[model samples]
Target: MTVVFVLGVLLVFVAIALLAMALRPAEEAEGLNRSLAVIEAIADAPKELRKDLEKPFGERVLEPLQQRALAVGRRISGADAEERIRRSLDLAGNPAGWTVDRVTASKVIGAGIGFSFGLLAGMVLTDALTLRLVIAAVGVVLGFFAPNMYLYQLAYDRTNKLQQELPDAIDLMTISVESGLGFDAAVQQVAHNTQGPLADEFSRMLREMQLGMGRAEALRSLNERVNLDDLKAFVSAMVQADSFGIPIAQVLRVQSSEMRVKRRQRAEEKAQQVPVKITVPLIFFILPTLFIAVLGPAAITIMDNF
Candidate 1:
């Protein structure tokens, strides 16, 4: 009770301090453009404007919590875990501001939430200490793996989108290239005219090249970012074409054809699995319902006669 009281007091004090800082007026802060300076300079700019000038709530508050949790996560996390998380993030297209540290911190946060919930529920539902501890342990395992599972799903969804969009992007680029634009210009055209993960990647690659990175290096990075075999093959072919002076249009046309073929194969594979996927549903749901409907009237009549 004493510890809880003290912690509550500390939380109240921190909340008060945060409110005070938010209300306190700033004075001649630099680095902001003139409009932002004027916005903050106002004695009574709306809360949103001041918010824009200050460190975002996430950065100021959540970031510290994440960092603290990440410290605990790092203590328990193996070196290979971090590497695998980074690779997974790459496969997920590295959503803006996502990092390995954030994911580790999320796992820690999730585990704590699960443990607390499990502990509370166990205490409320039963008096057995052993059972409560078991529940809490299960919670810990589920929470620890939850973030990774979600990240994997995200990567899978993004990769599928990339695959779906690849052939169209390639065709667009081929058209642009054959229309007298150079390879880079054709890529720019595709970026401008289309939209998807693949286009975003092409745009990023263009920007990297514009910033003085070699084409081969930029293309290699793109391949590293995505986890698709078809994309890897296309990148390899593009690199080779660039290196050997093969026409860009020819390379794109061939890749487009291959991508279409792969897309069809994927569709057929998924189609073939439909029956297998439906087996459990049919046994547990549809078949039982049909059997009951077909036999139910006869069974009732026979029971009446008996």
Candidate 2:
């Protein structure tokens, strides 16, 4: 027993050490530093390829682990999951540094860690072979899917935020256009003055347009990226307006008004559902507690008298 306990303790410490190492922040190099390195690489392109006599210790150690993780992920994850991950990343406004491959790697790493931890737990804490194997299997499955689940949640939350922020962004653009700014200028104004995913999308659309993409195409891409109904409606209207030579300001005003109405309707819908949402808690928790508190003393008195 003593030997087993000591081994378990050692295993736990090793796991903790590994976790700390993984969580430690990497050294951040500045943009200029990166540019200078790139310049040097370009300047050295003509030189013969010479192998580094001594690679950085961390790189030497980590590269093999990263490769293994990627391989493991490739084996476990399907192409469909990868495609879905890409869409989720887009929906999440492409949260900083999070990409499909990164999430896949994380899922692989998590599975490995979970499997190791489960094995150690089973050895230290259980005697039943079936239970131990089951625990380990469950751990592997959970770890493998956890990253995808988190990414889905991020996409869902960001979609909600985009919906919430859209009406205001439309209102801003409407105001800008009514004040005599051209449609493109109004879009630029919204991008510059507003802050949110919608504004960021506007800025990206403008950049796309500036890069020679048609305004209609850029607006379509914007709608595709967000996958929101209101934005899609606005995009469709704008594209139609441009195609038919309708006044841009009129389109803007109509979109702005409709978005406000939709926002209010959403609010009212949620408000109406509140009581329904509260019903389960009220019955299961509050009513039961109230009944116990009110009837407990009376029941005790009746029992005593009997």
Candidate 3:
């Protein structure tokens, strides 16, 4: 009995050490902690953590692991995790604008939820301790990566939306310029007249140009922010037109036409892909069901005869 007790104690210590090793990756842990701390420091943090986070934003806002506390604060205050992340990033200097904030928030939330759900699923599906642990580990990994997947999707959607709008915007600008407005004035007019994600971006570009950024530099920054191939091509065309002193209206008209062609090609390509995409479902689902319906009665009849 004494030997068993000693062995049990050793096992407990070993378990604790393993947990520490698994959980204590210093940099990542610190980053999570800092994020929690910053969240708690926000004015709307719950009463309990607010007192703790009352210290200066820079210090307490980046303190140690406070996940439980932050979670509690969130529950009490009803703050959305994504919104909290956006506010935190804004306060921290808004690098990459709201896009970075969205990606970071998604990653943090995805990892936490994924790991928790995965572990819960493992517990429900298996009795083996090793399998459970493996599943939990995989859950954590998948959760951490899930946010990146979402971010990529968001970027792709945003780029596509911008591309879809680009030709229309360019055509509008072309008409405005040809109708007697200066190029800069036409850009500003388009920025004001349209209302969408693309217009928001154009407004920012107009602001930058008005603030004394060179036209080329402003267009480059716009391209970087939008990060769409079509927008980049449009920017390149505009730069060439400006450098060579060509008419802005002609440049806009040509780019607009090219963008329309590209859009048409993309639509055709997606239409062509539908049959290939449908094949997997037909093979796996419909075909199997049809086979079962046709063969099931025949098999049963044969068995009856035998």
Best by TM-score: 1
Best prediction by lDDT: 1
lDDT of 3 by residue, 187-240 (tens): 888889998778878888888988999998989877766667888899999988
Ranking by lDDT: 1, 2, 3
lDDT tens digits by residue: candidate 1, 1-306? 999999999999999999987776555234346677665577577767677567778898997999899999999999798899999988888878789988999999999988988898889888999999988888888888888988899899999999888888888888888889998998898888888888899999999999999999999999999998888999999999999999888888888888888889999999999999999999999999999999999999999999
The superposed Cα distance between candidate 1 and the true structure at residue 258, in angstroms, equals: 1.3
Error of 2 at 137 (Å): 2.3
Please state the error at residue 65 of candidate 1 in Å: 2.9
Model 2 residue 237 CA deviation in Å: 1.4
TM-score of 1: 0.76
Candidate 2 runs further than 4 Å off? 1-58, 75-82, 120-127
lDDT by residue (tens digit), candidate 2, 153-219: 8778877888998888888888888888899998899889988787888899999999999999998
Score candidate 1 by lDDT.
Answer: 0.89
* RMSD over all Cα atoms, model 3: 15.4
